[model samples]
Target: MTSQNQTFERLCRTGTSLSVHSTYEIGGEARHLALPHTIEEVSTMLEGATSKGLDPFLFGMGSNTLFPDRPSDDMLFFSLKEHIEFKLLPGRLFVSAGTPMTLLALFGLYTGIPSFDFMFLLPGTLGAGVYMNAKYFSHQISDVLETAYVIDKEHPERGLISVPLSGCEYGYKKSVFMRKPWIVVGADLKLPVDPQLTPEQTDELFAKIKSKNLSTSVLPNYFRHYTNELNAAARAGYELRQELLDVITDRGGKKHFDYPSCGSVFKNNYTIGEPMGKLVDRIGLRGTVRGGAMISDHHGNIIQNRGGATAEDVTDLVKLVQEKVEAEFGFVPEPELVIV
Candidate 1:
């Protein structure tokens, strides 16, 4: 066997539960799953998969993805969630794709920079955020991203290719990354001001954050951990920003972490002049259920796995929402949830 094949075999876990990897807490057992901790490992795995004629399905955090109930045996599922890294540079911050988006908020809090406050409590990792142009109200990942480093999926050996902010072609919940066969590895974020700490201190702070066991995909656990971090920072006299505190209030009020969900299931139709949640509410579809999945009563845009929900259950509800809304509103809402 080739060294890359051996390395990939060592990384692969057989009969892994996809449920634990997704915030939605659905999906059945996957035949092969791998979590690569470095870019080289990722390349090795991809090369090995190519040699085996196995299609690779790449994801990060699984916050917005719906894995199949019966995954194909020929597919190789992999995630970059274990590859978190952060580096402070001259005028920008370099963050690995696996780093949680919410961590950027904590980084900003420590550095006394408010540019990343919008990422507070944002679910998913940096790669997925950049892929989807993740947004919170008016702020989005595109606003802060300066350059994204990616690997062409067709040619992993070609190594990292940099795409500047201007080349990303970002729009509302859209980016050029979405149109290309590329895997985002990391990005350089524009810094609004100099950080409050020295380079060594920054490294120490990131090391501390990385040491914490906060990488679980469970929504409630993820929420409680970050909220506690914010409170701890406030106790340390970091002076919590109102914007950061308000994120807690906003997301908490929406019950975003109360159940297993992939957050908003659909993109809002701009011409409709109303958000997806409001439209769902208007169509009297809030609290609708299919098996164990339910349209969240608190937020109509969300479909939650209340308990023991399967991928089919969630997709059934998604279709129901799409059908009912289209019948009423004369337009079908496009799903934001990525069904794998």
Candidate 2:
């Protein structure tokens, strides 16, 4: 479908707030919200927004992000999240930007390839993940990424553009896409796919995983999730059993997932000798509460929403932690979350 053919009236909504769209459940209302399901729809909305002198921004699942208390009426937010695509080709995965990481993981697991297990537990949509070079433990999506289909915001007339992995310049939580007006529409993942796994073998692996009684604690709602590698390691007696358990388990394993909060308020200082969370813990910031926001008693890095917590409440606690942590260690930590 062409943008010229689809009417803007059909794709846009008015008086929508960020709290309803985001995972953090924060942000004020934008003047317009457009749920564009096609490339043409996206282009059309962008053109219309610009023509009206409105500032438009792309929004994904809203994970790891923060927005203002009251957005201006000129702001327009575009979402392509509902138009998702995922399919297994002979050797690679063809996934749209809106596809969930959890689905990617399950696809890999079912095919006898378990490398993406780390991603299964991650939050946010594929587009956001790719833009941020989303990392889990030691792995980032860049490690397995091959090519991404991008919409060059500067030149939408070029149509859907395909760029190789090198064009992205992905780093730890940074990418060229973040710098430019590039919007990822789709991506190709180059991960191992097992063709030898018979129906019996597939069933056996599925049964084994199911038998573990995997916690149905709802991953997106949680602050952190377990990696599939840990499960595989445990099953294979990977020799680092105790160490892996220690690394993977925090506050009674899955308890961290029970709380509503953006996980890890601070980004790790690459030059720091230890994790920022450790410094937060050593400074006795754990269990500190402000309004409905509380520094998790289980992990120092987390600021959880006890109940009915607003974005301001979380910001207050974040400031408090920064003040105390900096005073104690003489090191200011960077925020991993995107505070708009």
What TM-score does each of the candidates earn?
0.98, 0.79
Tell me the lDDT of model 2 at 88. Answer: 50
Residue lDDT tens for model 1, 233-255: 88889979989989999999999
Off by over 4 Å in 2: 1-6, 194-254
Best TM-score goes to which candidate?
1
On lDDT, the leading prediction is 1
TM-score of 1: 0.98
lDDT string for model 2 (1-340, tens) is: 4455347767778888777676556678877788777667777777777667778778666666666677778878877666566555567777778666655665554555655655655656678888888877677889888998888766667788888999889876788887888888889898675456566764575455434332222334333334554456447654333323443453336355666656678878767688877888898888888877788887888887786667888888888878887888787787887776
Go through the candidates in order and give each one's C-alpha lDDT: 0.90, 0.69
